[model samples]
Target: MRQSPALRILAGTALALLLGVSFTQAASSTKAAAPESSESFDYGTVDSFAGAFLAARTAEADRDYPNAIQFYKKALDFSPNELELQQRLMIALFMNGDFDEGAKLAKLLEKDPAVERVTSVALSFQAIRDGSYAKAMKSLKYEGPNDLDRLMNELLTAWTKVGEGKGKEALKQLQDLKGPSWYSIFTNYNIGAIASVVGDEDGARKAFTETVTDKNGGATAPDTYARAVMALATLEANAGNKQKALDALSAGDELITNFAPFKALRDEIEAGRKPKPVIETAAQGAAGVLFSIGGALNRDGAEDTVMLYLQFSRALDKEAADTLILLGGIAEKAGQPNKAIEFYRQVPETSPMRRISELQLGLTLAETGKVDEARAHLQKLIASDPKDVRSYLAYGSVLSDAKDYAAMAANYDKAVEVIGPAPTRNHWSVFFQRGIAYERLKKWDKAEPDFNKALELNPDQPQVLNYLGYSWVDMNRNLQQGLDMIKKAVELRPDDGYIVDSLGWAYYRMGRFDEAVTELERAIELKAGDATINDHLGDAYWRVGRKLEATFQWKRALASEPEEAQVPAIQAKIEKGLPPIEADAAKVNAEPAAEPKKDDKKT
Candidate 1:
């Protein structure tokens, strides 16, 4: 089973119950007409209790915590004793950074077994804030579920022990931690952090040394290991061993390539600046504990738990940039672009990760359909550091989202100019993206050379191989070599249905009907509900004289929602069947009738 699966289930049936029976349906019925301002629209501006609850759930599902909190409160007022409503409201409040408010609701629900999961965390955090170490320990209890909750409880309890001035005791608790092999990195890192907080420098040094020394641990838990290295390096630097500090950071670099924190810390030590301790308080150490587990919990279906950990970490140390960035990324991936923008905007201006967050903010704005705003924001970023290739990339991404291929090409042209003529393998994406823009603009002469240049820099790149190969096949030239390139792409990315479809489509273009049918069927299995894949399969089936199956596939494509531009053509094919063949397979390839679409579907 997946780690931390039970973490989100702490609230019992609140997730489903709070969401109620009518979320989008009820919420859609309550949408407001045009407001006075062009800047905002309120889905929560509704008339009934059901509407309020539905709006709250719709917002919650979207991760729009601020709006969710407002609507949940409105719903709660209508039915005060609703356990699921109260529990969900608390979660929304916590997620929106109103930790104290969320905790207050948890306080009332503390004795309820169903609400214990949220209460355990909320109450423990409140106790930690109030400096009641014993109360914190008592508040953190959960016997159900897997070991993840138990692990978090123990770590938080250990931090309280550190707060109680039992530093040695905290270290012992961590040393004594028992769980799966995956627990080692977090355990060792916390042990070192507790030791540092207690001023046991030698103990801290030894534990951190051990923590970072586990190269396999570093790979599994790179962020935790990187922090352990920084902490170890700080201990050395403060003790007047500057070279040792540098060495620790150098080791960190080997473990996690180009971590900004390590780079910054190393620069400080090299410039004779004494490094500060990475952990200044027990609370900060506890934050790291959350981050370790929370970072590991980041997966597609586990976002709620991952977000909970990061949000709790923020409650302990509000300005922690790493927590903020991770939270923003989770929001982004969850399709809550507005929520993602809020989190990204919170990363401190002084943070090394500030620029990265800003880039994310711009992309999220575009996702939210604020294309003009995104472009303006990225334009300022690009102008501020004209020589930075990342700034150009961020700007280009906004242009790509806006479908302004000309602007995207211009952006990459500037990136190429900034990098000068000595472009390395690292610069392959710049060439590849520029090539896409040129191809999208129907300038294949320009696009082809850039694709070749990209492959020269990174010969085995699957995307470039697929694009160039597909283009050659579509143009009726270099048939065998083009097919070979596509085959190579499929070999490199066996599970990628898009690449598989390219291979099938290439065979269809060459009139190899049987082979096309086989590959297209595989592509359909891999990428179900893809209109383009279904359409291609339909065409391939028709050529093989499986007319009945071909008709079924065409109807399937229409049901999958082919683009508006493609609907009439698909309908006509279904109505009258494919036109009669004018030539045999070889002749068809020798004189191509039309270019196959390069879009996920072709024209």
Candidate 2:
């Protein structure tokens, strides 16, 4: 699955919903209403109902699904006809893994015109689980309101057909799916799965081959691509083509190294054991469908919606390590690192992905402020697997975060040693990070070579170009070349304020006051709150005779909170203007005597 950029700019309404602030108004409005009673017991009053609802929303915002469910239920006991409440309750139950109760609520919600696509999907999965094939087919027929929704609906329908024992028909349905070019990889992958489950070895081989060969397969649907490769490898191993099976596993490994299923299959093949079918039963086939779609949705930032699908998938196939990893990732993204750690911990010890999960767990431990534990955990991983460069990198990153540059550099050195002298293009990050570490330690000679090597390996990488260029210009060496490099970096990352500031500061150092003023103004516009950029702009303004503007810029810089060591200097400059330069007295005195001697010779 390809991760999408974060949607940090949530609209006010969405933010309110996520934070449960929307409930506050509703709760306050209901405070004066009367109590209601049930046949068996006395339910809470409207005020109590409002209080429970508010609590539920708060709990939901915090990702405390069980408490949210409890409060939602309490609120529902007072007011059962509230459709919005019903929807919230259903989602909470599903997210809490109480799918049976969620499904029950979903049955009622299916009639709601405003019901979300995820609710419909949950109902369909419930139907499938209960062996109600007709109802499942009906649920699948409800058209989705968007492109992704429609595609998922069609895919789920086809999988439902497979569950109904019409595997050939299921394959036909997938073949007929016409959508965007992005749908091709998923379509081919599911076709391969349905074929494999239906005992059509030749058909399965053909579909899996197409899926593997699809150019967009890796970028758009990596998890599905990896699954296809594993399926193809299993087919080859079954056919007694040991080398071909290994080759298939190698292909999958290139796409996603250390995938547990792929590693397990490779191990079995190497040991002369026949690997199991990738999708053995109809239920697992349904689980695969859910996993693929859910994994994709997870990447697209529909964490809550995807969580329900993955939970259902897990219920169907508990051994799906990829599903577990995706769940953990969702938890991490939701800012529930403890929950993420729990999911990561559930990865089977026999799986190759177990190590990757451990690595993530260590990072998440750090996120929770258990820095020492995270460091120790990652250190143990490095000690156990000395050749695993990732372990070293993870440990190094932890140390880097703690501002321990020396330790970070030493860890990267260990990584370089483990990787041997012949570092591949992929090893560029190791060098880049080590360079950053050395630079932070003020070891310029060591840092410069590492940065140059990083450039050699990954030419024109924006961060490397910007850093190396800025360093050279700051040191008054390679001024023009450094300026050129910084310019190129700005072009590459036009929105990066710091790179733009470097260009401006370079001009200032070269005494191009006017040009510095223009570029520095632009940099300040780009990053108005950056103290260094503000200070640099102030210096340029002062040089250009905009003394008043320079004073204002300096005030802004002071307000922006510069580094502690630099504060006193900026304060001193604000108190008194820059010191005057000494006159070249020798040059001034020698010129007159030379002119006089020339005049005497002429006479």
- By summed lDDT, which 10 consecutive residues of candidate 2 come out lowest? 590-599
lDDT against the true structure, each candidate: 0.76, 0.73
TM-score of 1: 0.80
Task: Please provide TM-scores, in order, for all candidate models, with all chains considered together.
Answer: 0.80, 0.79
RMSD in order of candidates: 6.2, 11.6
Residue runs of model 2 more than 4 Å from their true location after superposition: 1-78, 96-98, 130-135, 144-147, 176-180, 249-278, 297-312, 511-603
Tens-digit lDDT track of model 1 for 1-603: 133334334323322232232334434555543233211426446655676676677677667787778778887777777677787888788767788998999899888766576677778888887778788888876576456667777888889899888888878888888887767878888888888888888888998999989887777667677778988988898888998888998888776764656766776777887766757898887777778777765666667766777887888888777788888888777766777788889987856456777777887787788999989998888787676676677677667666698999999999999989899886777888788788878788998889899999999998888888888887777989999999999999898787788899899888798999999999999989988889889989999999999999999999999767778878998998888766434344222112222221100
What's model 1's lDDT at 468?
A: 84
Shift in Å, residue 164, candidate 2: 3.6
**What's the lDDT for residue 387 in model 1?**
67
CA displacement after TM-score superposition, residue 563 of candidate 1 (Å): 6.8
User: Pick by lDDT: which candidate is best?
Assistant: 1
Please, what are the lDDT tens digits per residue for candidate 2 over residues 230-270?
88998988999999888888877776755656665777889
